[model samples]
Target: MKITVDRDACISSGICALDAPTLFDQDDEGVVLLRTDRPAAEDEQLARDAALACPASVITVTEVE
Candidate 1:
């Protein structure tokens, strides 16, 4: 899967980090930072959860063939 974060739409709620620390993080300014856009198979669920947990709905996960 491929993860994308809309920096302008991020509210800095940190939900993504809470749901998947390994895949997401916050920048010094508290913006969402993508640790890995291409997550491993094992982390797919967490990545999805993080995207859903985002209150701003800025996180997007796209299936990669």
Candidate 2:
């Protein structure tokens, strides 16, 4: 799966990082950071859940293929 995040739309929420630490992270200023655009198959669900848990709704998860 592919994961994308809109930093401009992020609200410093750490939900993404908390939910999917391997796929997402927060900068020192709390902006959303993309750890990897393409996540492993095992992490697909984590990415999806992080997307759903994001309060700012900035995280987007999509199928790579």
Candidate 3:
């Protein structure tokens, strides 16, 4: 899966980091930090979960064909 984050829209909720540490993280200011845009197959679910869990809806997950 491919993941993307809107830094401008992030609210520093850290939900993405909390849900998927490998795919996401929080910066020093608590902004959403994308650890990887492309996640491994095993981490597909985690990426999706992080996107869905983002309170500001800043995280986006796209299925790779």
What's the distance in Å from true for residue 44, model 1? 0.3
The number of the candidate with the highest TM-score is: 1
Cα deviation of 54, candidate 1, in Å: 0.5
Estimate the TM-score of every prediction.
0.94, 0.94, 0.92
Model 1, residue 4: displacement in angstroms?
0.6
lDDT of 3 by residue, 1-65 (tens): 77888999899988778788888888899998888899989999888777777788998888878
Supply candidate 3's per-residue lDDT for 31.
91
Ranking by lDDT: 1, 2, 3
lDDT tens readout by residue for model 1, 1-65: 89999998889999888889999999988899999999999999999998788889999999989
RMSD of each: 0.7, 0.8, 0.8
**Regions of model 1 farther than 4 Å from truth:** none
**Distance (Å) between predicted and true CA of 60, model 1?**
0.4
Model 1 sits at a Cα RMSD from the real structure of 0.7
Ranking by TM-score: 1, 2, 3
Model 3 worst lDDT window (10 residues): 47-56
Q: For model 3, what is the error of residue 31's alpha carbon versus the real structure, in angstroms, after optimal superposition?
A: 0.5
Error at 41, model 1, angstroms: 0.5
Cα-based lDDT for every prediction: 0.91, 0.89, 0.85
Query: Model 2 scores what on Cα lDDT?
Result: 0.89
